[model samples]
Target: MKSKTVLITGGSSGIGKAIGIYLTTKGYNVYGTTRNIAKYPNFNDFKLVQMDVRNAQSIKDCIDEVLTNEVRLDVVINNAGVGITGPLEETPSEEIVNAFDTNFSGPLNVIKAVLPIMRKQQKGLIINITSIAGYMGLPYRGIYSATKGALEIITESLRMETKSFGINITCLAPGDFATNIASGRYHAPVIKNSPYEKVYGDTLKAIDKDVDNGGNPIQVAKKVHGIIEAKNPKIHYKVGTFFQKFSIILKRVLPDNWYEKLLMNYSSK
Candidate 1:
């Protein structure tokens, strides 16, 4: 059997890199994309290509390069996203646009670029990396949550639309993971006299700590491998700790006000 070719966006580091390396070891041909290929002069775990997810042309060129070398594009992981944290009121409009462009539209661009190739093959899989935060409107992270939540909802519709074409689409929402996302995320500065200053400051610290103490990203990588091997994958899969996954369930069962209170209480911690 020919090895499956996998393309992962933002595959240079964090969960993306972990997934690429793990799949490579599992006998899959993995091609990871980075905005700047020059940064990873030593990235040999898999094929690294240049791509800016925000740029459709870049995505096309990267996919073209991959198709040039491989016969079939088996899997596409839309894992390229940026982290944005701040009170929606305080975050700059431009920054908010950037966040949405990178986290939301970026994945759409990659999907559009690959769907044609996948449709021609008559069998393909697309896994979207969402977030547990997306299940709710997280304090100081509302925009980030909205972006992922939108993708999650979009995945549902996309799955049905492409099912007839032998294409599979699913979302994998992971909780906080120990990664370098903090260094790259856009953070709205806490103002000296602003109303949300104190609480926002505290929440920022907590968010950072959560990432610092979060679970190993390799766990997510393992989950991705399982999803790939499954015969019929579900529309939604979550990779996170007990509490993180449970939080989503709580929202579904608890009263709206109660769930809001629960989130507030948890964020205060």
Candidate 2:
């Protein structure tokens, strides 16, 4: 049984919870973070700690507590993030800031807190949760795409900067999954006369439908465990419906106009 400690953010539900529970069964010591532990009164599968990724101090404190006891932190999963929707022009400025803070900067905060400990240990892994949308901006979820894309770039850069110290970092660009994310997703208020109102509403509904009927979160957790066990992991990995995963290939090979039209049609479905 592997005894290394793994810390995962946003573990109260969805992929985070799935990964936490799955890894606990695999014999790895698991610690999961959530802003409110009260919601999980019966959460006994693994340890759950209070953490808010948007707050740097909260992140630091959580990692400190884990390292204070665990002594060696093995894996860090940056999965705690939020989603925001609407056309770029109409999305509230504060919402955009909050989205980026949670999605992009949030990972950096966790990584910053754990890097020193991992580097000292001379071995660690950081698995960033990006998205298929990170590969390309979706119509109404542009900010969400941008935030995840930023994390992907950050992960790539971090891999090059940390490998010499034996720290590995990679991103998981999942297509869509059945999760509680939609319940918490924020939508920008479209004005009664906004030009984007029609397409935005249609696209939002389609995206939500796609997510509501998407892949099981356990599939993602299993891949995360495999990546953690592997001797060498890729810079980026994809998990989700076959079509969403294939979109990456299409984005690379298809003509610009064709791909744009395809994306538009799909988003507007």
Give lDDT: candidate 1, residue 228: 100
TM-score of every model?
Answer: 0.99, 0.97
lDDT tens digits by residue: candidate 1, 1-269: 99999999999999999999999999999999999999989989999999999998898899889989999999999999999999989999999999889888999999888888899999999999999999999999999999999999999999999999999999999999999999999999999999999999999999999999999999999999999999999999999999999999999999999999999999989
* lDDT, residue 8, model 2: 93
Against the reference, the lDDT scores of all candidates come to 0.95, 0.90
Top-lDDT candidate index: 1
Backbone clash pairs in model 1 (N, Cα, C under 3 Å; residues 3+ apart or in different chains), count: 0
lDDT of 2 by residue, 244-264 (tens): 889999999999999999988
How much does each candidate deviate from the true structure in C-alpha RMSD? Answer: 0.6, 1.2
lDDT of 1 at 73: 97
In angstroms, the error of model 2 at 145 is: 0.4
lDDT, candidate 2, equals 0.90
